[model samples]
Target: MNGSAGAIEGCYWQADRETREVSPALSGDIKVDVAVIGGGFTGLAAAYHLKVADPGLEIAILEAETAGFGASGRNAGFVMTLFGASVSMMKALHGKERVRQAHQYMVSAISALEAMIGEHAIDCDYERTGFLKIATAPAYISLIQDEIELFQSLGIEGFEWLDRDQLAARIRSPVFLGASWEPGCGLLNPVKWLNALRRLACANGARLFEGTRVSEVQRENGRYRLTCDH
Candidate 1:
């Protein structure tokens, strides 16, 4: 594929806007206190948080392409509290307490994200429209009920079972039998949110290098050295 093809191919988010200017690649050896591999949501958020915690820490984010060029820019932006495969699966695998903790963490994370967006004035078209895990079959109704019951059992509120009529009132969908409605959920434009994060990380003194692919990393005299493609 040619340059810009990856950005245009599968990412509707990137394709919707004008092409973004990529940051310059690494030209020579550089040193930093921390070297972040990718420039996706996780990396950008980590860099931002680290800088906020310690403004003197030197951080660098190296990305193969531009920031948000990967799944960060190309995902259905559903900011819900569903961890792992399902609530039941999480409970089965990690027990009830862990599931509850996970749910609470996700809730806190969503709230923090919303607060950050407001504080930074990030224009990502964020909307707390809630989430609906709709049940299309009668059997799935029982599953939804079980999930809601599990949430209640775990002391996790903000979730309710919406019957067919109630769900239809919210959304005129004939195929939906019922849905697990979580009022704390939200949606946003992923690419826009990522771009905002990129800007915030840079503004907070996080150096970001696009088109810089890390080829190898080695420990040298108790410190780390990264080799990147030229």
Candidate 2:
């Protein structure tokens, strides 16, 4: 690390094409049916969907920086199905039924996202490269095997186990003893995708404000009042 992490570029997603579109800052007070607090993936997705669901709905997104300046812009572009830990971990905490539901939900989310991108003709680099949860040590091999067993026991499709040779065929790595391969995954440029989503939201009639930092949010008479630095 030659330079400070903060000083380094947020991500390589923006390297190919620097500078996407940016919205203007909030100038004065305004009102809307819905006021979204951030311009990242969650906020932009909400604004986009709300407009699509009800074309007449009024929605606004407020952000202190550009649309993709937050966490959504800086993540490694891997749209994966697993979250936090293995499927067995999910079953332990939330039970087998809940795990099934959650897994289905996440899988559907990826599908919906891909559909959205396709429908909107977003040109963000999206590769259908499924992810592999590889085991680095011998101890982890048993963990991977157990995860595969859980996947089978739960009748979860699209998940399979790969032996060392099979794993090497996909990704040549000396440390990989085995790996769990799931087809429900993809690679993408998150920042580029965010910018495209921002543009799409704007085109769908969602008002976006940039460089407007929200300092406090309060509920006043059943409505939210947001104090900000505009």
Candidate 3:
């Protein structure tokens, strides 16, 4: 399967074999602590987490294509800054101090991801080149400025507000009216990242079966039976 997202060009991982289109379904019954459905990040993460949580537990990953042959392989590798709820919502949900803590967690996650990459020696080409959020209208400037203030108030550094000239100087784009830059965000080849995770999963004693598709999974007498059709 070609896992490249809409505009991103390139596969998600390296292939050690030819692309023989095959959907060899599971044939026999298997048992495990968790039965993951997809081979994307969620599934892979689950498998990895489970293995780390308990090495004795059986973990299996059934992939229809090679590892990282899904959306996990084709994504804009942006560890997005903590921007989900508005500042108002953050204040409402947990107040200012808690909101700052939550933001810290987001930054922590990025650091954790980098640490994972280094600890496992997963060569996915990760970098902390920072991130830019551009505004297309003057109305958004207020919101952007508010964010900058919040960052400064919370002692979050490396965030800068870019005016028209600054924005133009940083990015040669005529559409943006202004922009917010953070030094904590960057991009990477997701395909390579996924592949590296797969390798780590294998090294950690997790069995990954590529080109294996699970057609039917039914519980029978407290045991799950998986049927594979190729």
Among these predictions, the greatest lDDT belongs to 1
In Å, residue 127's CA in model 3 sits off its true spot by 1.9
Residue 230 of model 1 has an lDDT of 81
lDDT of each: 0.88, 0.83, 0.71
Better of 1 and 3 by TM-score: 1
Could you give candidate 1's per-residue lDDT for residues 63-151 as a string of tens digits? 98878878898899988887799888888999989988898899999999999999998999899999999999999999889988888
lDDT of model 1, residue 89: 86
Name the Cα RMSD for model 2: 3.8
Residue pairs in steric clash, candidate 3?
12-191, 25-228, 25-229, 26-228, 130-185
Residue 136 lDDT (model 1): 95
Q: Model 3, stretches more than 4 Å misplaced?
A: 1-25, 64-66, 83-98, 150-158, 210-230
Tens digits of per-residue lDDT for model 2 on 108-147? Answer: 9899989988988888889889989899999999988888
lDDT of 1 at 99: 89
Greater lDDT among 1 and 3 belongs to: 1
